[model samples]
Target chain A: LAKTTQPISMDSYEGQEVNITCSHNNIATNDYITWYQQFPSQGPRFIIQGYKTKVTNEVASLFIPADRKSSTLSLPRVSLSDTAVYYCLVVGMDTGRRALTFGSGTRLQVQP
Target chain B: EAGVAQSPRYKIIEKRQSVAFWCNPISGHATLYWYQQILGQGPKLLIQFQNNGVVDDSQLPKDRFSAERLKGVDSTLKIQPAKLEDSAVYLCASSSRDRAQNIQYFGAGTRLSVL
Candidate 1:
């Protein structure tokens, strides 16, 4: 079974901010939350990852609270190209098990 | 600096027939993984390899699916008796443990259509 849960779909207008949240209540302490974006007919592309608190990169920002039960991926000023499936993955560091278990992604539709 | 590579971008085969997909990871990568992505769902890990040895394949259906990385660089995934439900995009990804993060880079994937 997948360790993460996300919405099946979301809608947003161009230039607006989009936030997608994922719940991983069973996340372990050594687990790190990573996000990826997948365009139609293409493989997934890495977005951002975080263990705790907040992690900001050029593409997006990841926010995690103290409980670490959930995390949010924030996209600033969304565009039509941002319309794609977003996946949240829990990676166990140093576990030597780098295999990723993906869940049903959240489809974000960005309209003009 | 080349990314993970997979061959036969598209394939169409009849059920019960055999098919194979090949992948070559980025140079110096010690870890390789194969995933199956059904339409309308996320990718599922089929198998994982660490330098020519199987590290994980609990999700793989051993009844029909098999994989190997002989040279610890290139790998192949084969299905002996394909089924209709086996139609999906097969993706190969590789990552380096030498780095601090375990970020995996994916290939374009091979779309298999089993009729």
Candidate 2:
């Protein structure tokens, strides 16, 4: 499993774009970068995932540079309801036998 | 489609007692996972199951923890002689067939308190 490091916490205002970056220097070729959002008392929900370059979804965007050493999660127009812990995961593309290894997620506080 | 479901939303037991949690994954989801989340920490994977077989359980304390996905649809996780440190939320999650692009859907989780 690839080890990931991210900020402990961050603060942002509503309607602003928030970027959370994660570093996984030891990522393998088969590994993919995935992000999850978790609200208090609920299970984490997948926000976006990317193998390289950038991928955009209705909720967020993921940017991975050439080195794959790090990736960024961009949430556009943040809202108070977006306050939650964001987890970055590096796992193999093989789904059948893979289990997620979660890291200390970055807690985003979307203030009004 | 219904999401993953875990039973016994909350459990409080004395040390040395036993506790069990149940999970029902999405109707056709072939992969299931159990994770333990301690307060102030991200969830740790305890076990993973693919259908009725064990895919990964390296983190599970086999000596005291055991889990089974008998029918490949519903599963159970048990802890015998629970300890105080076992107090945390046990979460169950499921994903669709395409593992790479698939998103994991999680249940509310079972919060256990071992005194």
Candidate 3:
């Protein structure tokens, strides 16, 4: 399992672009970076995932560099509903067992 | 097409009491996971199951907690003599085996409050 570090909190206004970065210096070659969004009183939902470079989805975008040591989740035109904790996970796909290790997560507050 | 389902959305019990949570994973999912999420913290993986066999349970408190996935469909998690520190949300998630990425679908979770 790889450990990830991210900002404790971030504040952004509605309709603005919010980028949350996570650092996983020990990321292995078989590891993939994944992001999840968790709202109050709800389970975390998958936002986006990337092995390297960038991957875009209907909800968010993920950017990874060549080193694979860090990745960023970009949310475009944020709204108040986007206020929630965002978790960055480094998961290994080679293993038969699959489970995510979540950190404290970055709490994004989309203010009006 | 249905997502994971969990029963007893909320539970309130006194200290030293026992509580059980049930989870029904999405159809055809081969892997299941149990996590514990405390207030102001992210969800922590408690155990992982592949069908009816246990994969990883390193973080599970075996002395007081027990879980089973009989017949490889639904799972039950029980905590004996709960403590105040055990007050947290228990989450259940599942994922398919064919997908290249480990994308897990989660349930609404069972919130346990130890009073």
Candidate 4:
């Protein structure tokens, strides 16, 4: 598993776009970057995942550079409900045998 | 479809006592994982199972913790002679490789308090 680094905390207002970056300097070729959102007293929820380039889903977008050392999770039009901790993880995507290892995460506080 | 289910959402026990948590993954998900999250910290993988067989348990404290996924569906995790440091949320998650993406669905988790 590749360790990830992210900001400890970030502040954003409602209707703003929030982007959290994760750095996995030792990412492997078989590794894929994944993002998960966690609110207070709840388990982490999968947000988006990508191996390379950019991947967008109904909830958020994930951008990976060519080097794959870092990735960013972008949340559009944030709302008070979007206040949560965002986690960045790099997992080995082979044969689906690998499990996720979460980090301290970036706490995004969305103010109304 | 229903999501992962866990019971005894909250538990409080004295140190050295035993506790068990149950988890029923989403139907048809072959992979299940148990994680422990301490306050202000990220979740740490304790074990991983595939179809009733364990894939990883290196992080588990085998002497005190045990888990089983009999029948390849529902699972249980147990801890005996628990220590104060063992107080944390135990999370159960399941994922299927049907899409080549291991997107896990998590249960609300069992919060354990060791006094």
Q: lDDT of each prediction vs. the true structure?
A: 0.88, 0.87, 0.87, 0.87
- Who is ahead in TM-score, 3 or 4? 4
- Off-target runs (Cα >4 Å) in candidate 3 are A92-99, B98-100
The DockQ for candidate 1, computed on C-alphas, is: 0.59
For candidate 2, lDDT tens digit of each residue in A2-108? 46789999999999999999987666676678899999888888888899999999999999999988999999999999999999877532334354567689999
Residue B110 error for model 3, in Å? 0.7
Estimate the TM-score of every prediction: 0.94, 0.93, 0.92, 0.93
Number of the candidate with higher DockQ, 2 or 4: 2
Worst 10 residues of 1 chain A by lDDT: A91-100
Model 3: per-residue Cα lDDT over B22-64, one tens digit each: 9999999999989999998888889888999988797899999
Q: What TM-score number comes out for model 3?
A: 0.92
DockQ for all models: 0.59, 0.67, 0.62, 0.57
Candidate 4 structure lDDT:
0.87
Q: Rank the candidates by DockQ, best first.
A: 2, 3, 1, 4
Score residue B1 of candidate 3 by CA lDDT: 93
Which RMSD does model 4 reach against the true structure? 2.7
Task: Write down the TM-score for model 1.
Answer: 0.94
**TM, chain A, every candidate:** 0.89, 0.89, 0.88, 0.88
Q: After TM-score superposition, what is the CA distance of residue A55 in candidate 3 from its true location, in Å?
A: 0.9
Best by lDDT: 1
**Residue A16 error, candidate 3, Å:** 1.0
Best by DockQ: 2
